[model samples]
Target: MTGPSAVPPVTVLPVGGHGLLVELPTAEAAEALHAELLRRRRTGTLPPVREIVPGARTVLLEGLAEPRRLAEELPHWRVPPLSRTGGTAVRIPVRYDGPDLAEVAALWGLSEQEVGAVHASAEYRVAFCGFAPGFGYLTVLGAGYEVPRRASPRTRVPAGAVGLAGAYTGIYPRSSPGGWQLIGTAVDTVLWDPERTPAALLEPGTRVRFEPVDSAGTPIGDSADPDIPDPDIPDTPSGSREPR
Candidate 1:
């Protein structure tokens, strides 16, 4: 069946012994299928599987007892476009002073301040989580905010660094090498905590917004204090690469 874009049909391929990789034409379509799978599984209509991992344009289902049977059935299941507004809302305070902020502004054809304004105005969703434990690949609801990755990969990117690459915006969970364009730094946010229930602050399907703030934890361009709550939990050290 055709996906949300309706340009191409869904393709399911066998992965390893018990996994099936379902590919779609677009990230939005993948999200739709992922949501549908979750709904069916919750309602006891889907087959048993160990994991359903969503990616930019694909969903990887692992631990299937009958991969070939499910693969044949996946192409016939109709899934609607995911609702952009559905998900848990999270606001992250960012200090727009990254090393690559000026570069990103020039690419966007806007001033440094305007860049922050534009980036902060968009509502983003966690399309998937990969590369690192707490790193989430966040995508905007609409189009036209794409950015190219850095020409040269950095030897080390500090934890809390907010970056943009292609259609995704991600934060570095810990210090590691990366190529994403750094646009800002998340303030008073713990990206990963082993002690936390979910460990990662940003999970797949979570809605996110960036709130521009200055030093001392006050909202920029306004007198009101956002009173952004501190994560307060100790971070777990990780050597994983930054999320793409």
Candidate 2:
């Protein structure tokens, strides 16, 4: 609120036996701080840290050798504003046809085609990954695009079902019960491949753009923008990403 509070007062608390929870006021502040901690860990300046897990408004520091020392030093850690360059981007092809497509269009006072255009045109980022493995909580590029979940939860949402919830969009990695507003479905992409190098295609801080596809699974839009492929995704199958 009020244009991101002054340096979101961080509250460090014991998370578990070997972890500490560094809380922030907003998701933006938390993500920025998580990036900073991750960068430090990559450079070997971090104190014996094993993992830096980012949440909506907190960063969980796990496998720390000295949790108390890190907790004491966390307040001094400076967090920068999130930049578009803060993370890697992955292109995902989607077909704009879900059970909730018409409902979502009506919610935003737009036609199904208009909704598809608006949705595909915006850039998104992985705010965090949870609820399900390989499922990412993606922040919408433009505001006023939030959609509420369904009145009744679906007992089995198929894998690759693209959905929107609150201020974020998500994809179902496997058949499971869910209540998010379904808007589309990604084409032929493996949301999770245990055999792949990076089992999860999406990761926290990763940028994502949903490219629209047609009934034949052909990419409707011309091409991908800012076509810098993420190397970490590994040899993905067809329909996930293609040559620009």
Candidate 3:
């Protein structure tokens, strides 16, 4: 159930309907496992596991004929490393015109320009996926940008909305009710047919940078934004960044 510090811990528990609960160190680790399982299923090493659900720090493995078989198989399973260049970067145009824009600025004691810099300045890691389908809770926003969620969540947060709450930032995959402070918007298709390859544009461990746009939601100029390497992806420590 536990591995060395370098290795992630694995726990096997029973959820209703015979699901195997696997606790991971972080969502990133769980994601790596999910991808690895998919790869193994294709390559024919691991047996067909079903309903691989990812959570904040847990991965639920379902449809194992016998829970003991899962426990024995766990020792042979390890999270695989994804290709450094295997994933694509998704660019989203943001209008930078949210109603809470000014409020967020004052909360962090930053000018509107400074606030924009913090949001657009760094690449974020998809730390975990939660709250809704296709919604990513990205980690490592510019340092001083940690703002709490709104006192009350919006009745309907439009799809493609880019918002920040606590130390995380995310895009609304659909029109969902939530409390993250809206800052901008992303037009990228966050969700679609789950049966399709690369079902979601955002994958775990992938990097993303916010590009500021105008009222029309077009790029700053001809729509080009520099890519910042995901500092959290590597073992190296991430540099300091301003808060959201």
Candidate 4:
């Protein structure tokens, strides 16, 4: 296998209800495609396609036209190369004082500080949008961090919980139940009313950096990078913006 032939061909399956899955060769490749799809959606250039879902190494394009129509139209869908803009990095403040923090650090054969260092060092890309609105499933962590989910699930994981499960790291967007190994807590107001011009905080192309916070979980102002834009998530406007 070489070049295009080596890569998984895009397979358009029968829309089993609303979506069809296509195998992607690698997580990086899938993330690059995911970013492209999101940009298209936001810019209104997406070719009549609806939701573009991403998995470990695959994407599911939902609500596309009939298979025959897609076969005709998809050839024109300009998928940008994987090496295109890796997009902006977001440095999120986190308190490395969660209930499961000790256990997770121990599993990685490191002290608490070492664990936090490992989490803070990586530039994790937003691999997909799922598990909830605005929640981003980030890719593999840097070396020395290979943790798994909790043996049993938590009744409720607070919104902004920074967790690790397998090779993936995730941020809990809303207050919800989860089983992932919680190493810290973040305070990003990720979700906002769609009335705002740009709603979600973590888009597909957005990269992430985790900054350790104080024991009280308050942002200590020690940011990894202070230049990233504060995503314009909005509150429910007082009739200022119209619903879509």
lDDT of 4 by residue, 1-244 (tens): 2354233345556557556675555565566566677787789866677677777787788886654565455434555555323555677888777788789868876778656766775556677778887887786464445677788899999888888887778888778999998888886456434776577777666667777768766655444443432222222112222232
Per-model TM-score on C-alpha atoms: 0.84, 0.84, 0.74, 0.73
Instruction: Point out where model 2 deviates above 4 Å.
Output: 1-6, 86-88, 141-143, 222-244
RMSD in angstroms, candidate 2? 8.0
Number of clashes in model 3? Answer: 8
lDDT of 1 by residue, 14-105 (tens): 89989999998767678778889999999999889999999999999999988888898888886755665565579999998889989988
Pairs clashing in candidate 4? Answer: none
Stretches > 4 Å off in candidate 3? 1-5, 81-84, 125-130, 142-144, 188-199, 203-207, 221-244
C-alpha lDDT (0 to 100) for residue 83 of candidate 1 = 66
lDDT of 2 by residue, 1-244 (tens): 3333444578999978789998987676787788888788889878987778888889988898778888888898765556665445788889999999999889887789767777777667788889989999987534456787888999999999999888888999998999998889999888788999899999888888788999898888554333432212222222223343
lDDT of 3 by residue, 25-65 (tens): 65556666766766777898765667776666677778866
- lDDT winner between candidates 2 and 4: 2
Better of 1 and 4 by TM-score: 1
* 3 versus 4: better TM-score goes to: 3
Q: Can you tell me which runs of candidate 4 are displaced by over 4 Å?
A: 1-10, 17-19, 36-46, 69-86, 142-144, 191-197, 216-244
Better of 2 and 4 by TM-score: 2
lDDT of each: 0.81, 0.79, 0.67, 0.67
lDDT of 3 at 45: 73
